[model samples]
Target: MTWMDEFWRLNAVFLVILLSFSFQGAHCELVVSPVVPTLVKAAAGSTVTLAVSFSGAPDPTVTWFKENLPVVTWTIDSSSPPDIAPNYRQVLRMRKDGSLTFVNVTRNYTSNYTMKMTKSGLGTAVTYFTLLVFDNIQNVELHLQPDPVKEGIDDFTLQYVMSQGDVEQQMWFFNAKEIKTDSRYSVEQNSLVVRRPKRSDTGQYTVKLENPFSTVETDMNVTVLYGPDEPILEARPDRPFYLSGDSLSLFCQAEGLPQPTAVWVFGGENLSHDGVLNLTNVQTSQGGNYTCMVLNGQTKEQRQKNMTLNVYERPSGNPVCSVQSVNRNTGLQYHCLWWGGTPLAWLSFPALSNTSSGAGNFNLTVTTSDNLNRKTITCVAVHPVEQNQCNVTASSPVDFLPAVRTTFDLGEGKIVVTIQCVSEASPEAVVSWSKGSEAVISGSTYQISNNTTQLEIRYYNVSSFLLQKYACTCLNPLGSRRREIQLRGPSISDFRLFPNQARTVVTLTWEVPPASVVTGFDIQMKGPNLPSENHNGSQIRGSSNKYRTIQLKPGSARSADVFNLDPDSTYRFRVVPKARITEGKPSEVQILGPGGGLSGPAIAGIAAGIPCSLLFLLLLGGFIYLCVYCNKNKSSRQTRYPVSRAVEKAITAQPDSTPHNLLTGGLKSPPDYNRLHQTPSDRSVALPTFVPPQPVRVATTV
Candidate 1:
């Protein structure tokens, strides 16, 4: 190699050794003195300090850690260094000697504290310290003696107590205001007392107990009791007076600390022990002074109330009903009365309020009618418990008689006879009709009215026999009455035949009936052989005759002509008046013939002479010769010669020894044609038969 290279290599080795020596001289070793302990104790709100010394060249960096976390770090700075952060600088401070100081330590600062120191180009140094912080005093409490203080009776006391802590000061407050101890109120170490505590002393009281580290406060409430007010008395009826049989009740009430009880007294006698006193159906004897006493159980105080009750009597009796007077306008007056009732408002009746007098009497006038006759008058006296009553009935009598009337109506070719029977009775009367001796049943020919007061008998083309006597009888529960009325036809009078017209055309003239009640006339003519008879045998009448009816105007009195009659023949005639209901009695008969006054023998002789001219000549001649020769010119001789031919034959044909002379012949065979034409009579062959002539009857009525 070259000289220059070797020389430089030697110089380099020398510089390297010099540089190693210098580095070894500049490096400093770490040394720790005054080691920190594991645990340190401190009081709450007190300061704590931690100190440490460490040696190292190129100054070592120091830092603090708790549970391996960095707490504080200290380092040397050249220029313009940043300020320490607030959290670490507030509670802890770093010194130039690498120690930490904690000011006013609390429980939160009781964890492990670590210190670290740092220098340029050197290793770091750290120290740890554990802290415990405690407070000896705790939360304060205030208690009260006589918790519910009774006002005017209790002295109040407030006691204060606390935990194990050093308390430096204690203060008292009432209602959040500072309280200074005085004569009225005083305080001890843990209690306060008030002398003669009034209701004003009942309020909230507080005690503030504090140590060097903490302050604590507590509150207590006090209450007091007071007195009740005076008692008040009340009554249910609200009135002091009452009538007999009234119900009464009393009440006693009061407001107090404790509820009050009542005692009731009547006229100095204790009656009840509750707050209410009730009396029912009170009498006059029970009326007196009543007192109610109220007492408080706890306060031992009492009150009294007094009242008086008055009872009056009410009148009672049975009501009396009497007939007062008869009123001209209204009728009968009746009055009801009761005497002397207190507060008459309680007594009542339908007519009481309308009375003319105020003496508890009622009057009413009733009319005399069917309603009054059946009515019962009543008087009522109303009372609270029961009602009094009195009643009377009215009496009346029946006062009328039966009346009968008959009416005739002619209409529609018929005649209606209405007979009405009526009577006035309290109860309606029943009426019945009787015709002659027989009862007239209603309906068909007889139609009775609804009330049986009227009966109507109807006839069409009525005849004389229908006229009759009718009796009407009316009956009720009280009595019976009868009335009779005759329904008569027209009266027939002056019945006769004209003498001049008696033989040939007989013109019979008759007077019309007296009344116009008749509508027609019936003419009955009986021949010599025929006869007519009526209902009764009072008049001579003959049956087997000819009848003819002739209508005439009503109310007319005139004559009728009858024609076509036989000559020298005897006839008897009668006329019956016809009405709407029936017929009247026939007129007396009149005989008409050739010689009107001739005897039956003369008539027969004349009739016999009418037949056979030869016998007529013989008889006439014989009669004349006898009259001349025998000197029998008397009326008896004339009568004896007038024998009918049939009688002559019977007399002449008799045996000679039969004792049949002229007188005997006259005695045995007198010739009345009706006697010879009997229903059963014998005739002789020698006598010629002769037929009696029949006449045409033409009857008319006016």
Candidate 2:
């Protein structure tokens, strides 16, 4: 190893150490405030301060620079020397202190300046600051927002920015109050916003600000812009609507801020220079398209829209009438209107509502026949153009004649019971009587009378059992009306009233049948008791059931007036009522008073007595007389024996033979029997029939 090499290595190491120490004390270390640094703008005539500190040196030489050029330098007796830039002035003092000052500032003097110093040559230090100087300051620009607003817009915003010679340097003021960005007043970049602008926003807005170094704050007045509101369109007199052949007119009108111009349109066509539009006469074609236009003069805007016009025509034409089905008493009616034709009109028919219309509406009405047949109605419409015609038809309801089965009772063992057949047929009805299922209306005991619509059931003795099913049936030729009859039990109301009294009021009552079967009630009552109850009683005739009672011998039983009655001094009472129950034969008397002369306090009667022996003999004699005398006489006179059917046919077969008697089983053949029987009285039913005569054969003994 050489000593020179060692010595040179030591020198290089010492030099490296010295350089490292110097870097560590100055350039390598940092000087910064935990407090943040800020930039301030100063007006041309204003001044501002900056803060600086060092993390490396406590006392060092300081120098100032404007921007990248040096401005001043200071040293503690060469501790920090002073340096300066051109066109700017500054003075530096504060011996051995770090404070520095500037005087007579100018606009260009404001800049970001840096200073550097060394601590006794042990360290080098540097710092950056803003040196702001103002020559003069002006107003800050303020923006009052809410432009292009509706009438009565209340809210607005006042905002400003700071400036030295630029708009960004100004701040805003509202009514002399400074404004900043916030919720109600916000600045989007530079434009200020005022939410919910209303009438209350009308106020003063001024901007005032200066650079951070300036003392003066200047303000500028601001104003907002508003508008003309929406316009409402109107028309003079009325809207353009007319009926055919009528005069029509319309005018455009509008209301808005600032005068508005109005225009009229017909079917979307603009109107002429004159304000009014006049149509001398209107037609159906004029029914469509009308409009109005409104132009706001202040806003310089126009609007137009269409409306509608309706034209109507007077009602036109009348309806037509026709007839439908016809019957004896039934008829039909029909009506049609001249609607839905050219010229578009309406029609009304009052007569139809009153006369024919009652029966005929849109449809036709026909009267029904008594035969229950439906009647047809027809309607015919005749138009002005003879060829134009319409027709319709309808049917009338079928008619139903209501009728019923009824009965009447004549009190007695042999009652005159009637089976009444009734119905509301158009013509008088014909009735036939029957016993059970037997057709007895034409027989000897039953005389069928078409004139009265009844069958007289007589000649045969009436018995209780026989009355059970005796029926009378009535029918019309058209079969529209039909009814049957029935027989029923009896009604016995009163016998004798008070005995020894002068005349008595006989209380009479009877059972009536179904009202539907009978139109009215026929009634009769009688007194006196029969040998058996409900047997033979005082005769009671056809009872026209009305009065409840009839005056009679008040309290006594009469032997003299006792025939179809109870002669037993114990009086009986019987009644026959018209409507309901038919007499099923004459019923035995109902005993109302005591047997043996009337015994009740008010009833009295005289009785005749017969000896037991005489009664036996009289009964025996009477029985024999009836059997022998009546039978014998009947046999001797029995020639054709009640006109038997055989004899009647024999005689009728010979047309040339003259009928001996209608009751003698004699007749002449008639081709049309119905015509021969009872033709109209208007016309003679007596007509002749042609038939060949057959020889009468005598009974031959062989």
Candidate 3:
């Protein structure tokens, strides 16, 4: 062939190959009409078609399935009719293009339909369709599980029911808003379940049932029975306290489903039935707790709130002001008092610039200056309802008469000393007793009688008693006076020992009464050894631990000096007053060696350390006791045999009268078998006497 002929031939072959590929590509591409599937709906007596179209093969084998079951099969190019299943043979029909048609459609024909196509070269193409047949959405009703739902308690359901048609889709709405399924709400088939409905759930609820052919909606008005919330109580012209004849008005409010009603109660009496409680000309008897109770008629729930009212009265008549002298005529006290009122009246001294207001009773003290004499003071009393004033005049101060009397009485083989103090003053004085610098109260040694005006010293010992002085004082807010009393007797006073720098040589001094009372004084000394020299410069070495006497003549100075004493030894010295016929009690003193005593701080440290040491020891002993007890309990638990529950119950039921055999019986037998089988009259029996075992003692030689 020529070159042009060859080119034409190659072009022809290439064009042919391209044309083959184009034809294969066009035929192999499967296209289904309306790629997204949609539901189909029709009336029961009407005809319907589940339309599905695909272009993959010209003579593909087509099969239709209803809910995964093959209902019909047909070939597009076959001349014979389509094959249909026995159940759908009467109502179902298939076209040559593989579309399903339902003739005289009934409610039973509604189902899911799937169309699948298969050819030799091409694989498979599948499409889905849902069919629903309905007559008409009529006689539709929404029923609730409970006619009246209880909030926060009952689980209620709203079910949609139709007598004529089937529902394809259902939706719920509350108060015009769609209700979404959540923890509190759920949709089950045609029912809407509300778990634990609340008060907020009370409203109009709508359920919409829809199919492709029709949509129907039903609404229900649900009222949730709820509580009458805590009543809101309010009072007009509110105040903490009110005066007599005051008016009061109280109002109560509450919110509930059925419109709660309020009732008023006070002091166990029904005051009112309405929300408003009015009190006109209220008296003190009406002051108390007032309750307002709100109730819901439908829910049968009630709530109450309380309010407190206090009524007071102003003071009657006039205030009284009095003046008295205090502090031993050095100052004057002016007092104002207003009594007989519900609440105490307020009193103030306007003229006294430094005084503040007081309740009921008020007092003002001023020094006894020239300005205070015969001065008139005014006391003002104020109350919520009224006010009053009074005046008092201060007079010249009066002097008080004070007297001290001593009386002697014999009792219990001893002489009792009684000291009495009498003071005549306005606003009576308080009497007190003191020994030296310390105040004394009634104790075993001293007794105070007659409202603290008389003091009795009982069981008197002359040696220690004569060394101290007693004082009685009569005191008031304004002033005080004191009187010193010394017991009359031939007794030594102020007995003291003065030690030298070496603490060996010492000097003794004392006080004594007149020479007529005491004839001569005898100085007695007892120690390890007698002093080598006395106050007269006489040397004497007496026997060890023997009493030595140093005599002093009457009218002599009460002092003595000793020399050459042992510093390591303790010495006791006694001074005795010798009367004309009888010897008086002796005053004694003891001197300790420098190395023989503990200091004050050391003694205090020992005293404080004793309790702490004792506490620690007590805690240690408790811990050991707890450990022993726990171990003993553990051992007992380990060694004890197991007892049946029945036996334990029986033993507990009749613990004191349980027989010994019942305690030791084996677990195979029932507890209290005889008691259970016996009649009431035959239950009583003779109980055997129990004897305690004696303890056995074992003796061993050490």
Candidate 4:
């Protein structure tokens, strides 16, 4: 209590003295001026004033404070009018009205300020002010960690940096539009984070920094480099195949920032660096996988696409040609084809009548003509791109005409001549034998036989009547052909043998054989002393005594002379005819003696020889009569016709069967009347009836 009272007594005494001083200072009237602002705002790096005006009788002193702490002190002087003593001299100043001013305002200068004005005779007056120095976003800029946004990628940071300023509020803008925070985008103190940026998030990014006193903005452009979405490569033709000499073009496309670069790769090698690849002439070797690669420099990302290209060629070689139809009426039809070609070209048959087949084939139709066998048909096919052409040919078969062949047999003293026709045909041909227009039958005079492709005619007991025209016909469904033949045999007449004066050699003579069918002759002779029992000389039986066979050389003389004959002995000679295929019977034997004349029994022989010779003459006359009559009516008969002109005579008269002196008796005699030609006109002259001459025997010198 005692300490409290002592403290109160001192406080009361001090209070009484302070009241007296306040009364006296109040009468002096220290007042601040009116119309002064208590708060101030300013831009960073710019001047601002906290206005403090007073109406005091004496100028008041000013003191500045920041955050309730003393900052600067100022007073008015009559000479200087204002004074300043600031904690930071370059920042704060004092005016005569007790107001505070900032020379260069910054964010650090934003605070509450109080100005205290006092004088010796006036009461104390204080003024309060708040200074909001806006940091005009100094050096405020929006920045990206990668500078540009990466499309389809992870988060990217967008930051705003201020060199010297404080921001109370901020707003982000993209392309002048405000940006907000979302799952894809976020906002931190001064940065904007974009999570998983897409291609759509590319544009100008702006930041608006605001304080209580001022507003400012900064902008930066954000580019989102998008990826080349599986770069698309396409061909100009758009087809999967190309010809070897065709033109081709390829285009590569992509979307990206910084204008992505393009690369084309083929067969593991880089082919082009442009967005489009052009090929003037493509080849088969140029076929392979084509790759298009697009690179984005800003994003450091690449995309690629691949396409397969193929080059092909048409088939090249000879075409296949086959016969489609063949017949007698339509001749031949051929089909030409070229298969397995990529692009089939038109086929043509230049030498024939060609028609197009619906497919890549050609047809040729031909008609029968005389020149068809001599002409050739060719088929040609050209490929679209091949250098060579396909060519083929067609031909017909052989065998269309008839050929005739003939043969003869002389086994039983009579001749049998056979004629045959041969030919070939597709279908079996019908063969037949005919005389003139009438078909020949299997009968006595003519025997006809026929097979599929041949005709045979057998003539039995051949005579002048058998030497007639015979025809062989062969026919098929397609066509027909015929062949004719006139067959005959040899005819020998005027047979004689004369002995030389020395009686050693004898010459044999005869008329040329009929029908040139005689190929040769065989002459037989026996010695005067014969082994046979007959009184007249007879020929030896075996081949041992036979004369050497003689061949009729094509153009040699017809006479054959015999040498080494016995002068004083009787000899016999005979002749056998040789034809194309057979030998004729031997003629009657003739007798020779040392007198170079016939040697035989005269008196007895005359008695028999006359009758026999008479009979021979009768038979010869009758045979000649028959040959004439038959030849005259040959045109009317089916199996009769004129024979070949090669025959000189068809009938020969022989002596009677008694065979003595051969009826001449070795004497030079007159021509016999019975020796007449077998034809009518040649023997038309009336002749005396033949009479057997008396067989007079002349004695031969021995």
The candidate scoring highest on lDDT is 3
Any runs in candidate 3 off by more than 4 Å, and if so which?
1-39, 44-46, 51-60, 75-83, 104-112, 119-128, 133-135, 143-205, 224-251, 268-270, 276-281, 299-303, 325-333, 350-357, 362-371, 397-702
Give the CA lDDT, 0 to 100, for residue 87 in model 3. Answer: 85
Per-residue lDDT over 1-702 for candidate 4, one digit per residue giving the tens place of the 0 to 100 score: 699999999999999868856775665466664255666767778887777566545545656667777766655665653444445678877666666778877777777777676666566777777777776446776667865667767688888877766788888887887878888778788898888888788877888898765577878777777876778778998886888789989999887777789999987888889888898788777877889989987677888888888776675555766543356434656577776555565677766644543235766666655454424455667665553434433333334433333334446333344455555443344567778778877776566564534444444333543457767766543456776766555545567777778867778876543333444567766544333333565533322244434324221235677775555565667666655435556555666754335344544455566667668766766876786566546533444334432222322444333233333344444334345433464443333233435543433221
Indicate the TM-score of model 2.
0.33
What are the Cα lDDT values of the candidates?
A: 0.59, 0.43, 0.70, 0.62
Cand. 1 Cα-lDDT: 0.59
A best-first ranking of the candidates according to their lDDT comes to 3, 4, 1, 2
The C-alpha local distance difference test score for the whole of candidate 2 amounts to 0.43
The TM-score between candidate 1 and the true structure equals: 0.23
Off by over 4 Å in 4: 1-139, 314-702
Cα lDDT of model 2 by residue, 1-702, tens digit: 699999999999999878867887556553433122535445544334444555454445666566777656666456334444444545332334443444434556556766666666456666666755554444445544444433344555455544545333555566767667776676555445666654344466654444444445544444333332333433344643445677766655554444556677775577643445676677767676677666765456566666566665433444553433334424433445555433333222333333432211354444444433222223333322322333332322223322223233344322233334554442333455556777674654455555645554432232332344555554433343334344333322222233332222233333333322221222223333223323463333222222232322211112113233322222333433222234322222333222322343312111122244347546655665565456445544543224434434543553433221111112223232322222233122222232323322111000
TM-score each candidate: 0.23, 0.33, 0.45, 0.36
Order of candidate numbers by TM-score, starting with the best: 3, 4, 2, 1
Q: Which candidate number maximizes TM-score?
A: 3
lDDT of 1 at 679: 22
Candidate 4 lDDT score relative to the true structure = 0.62
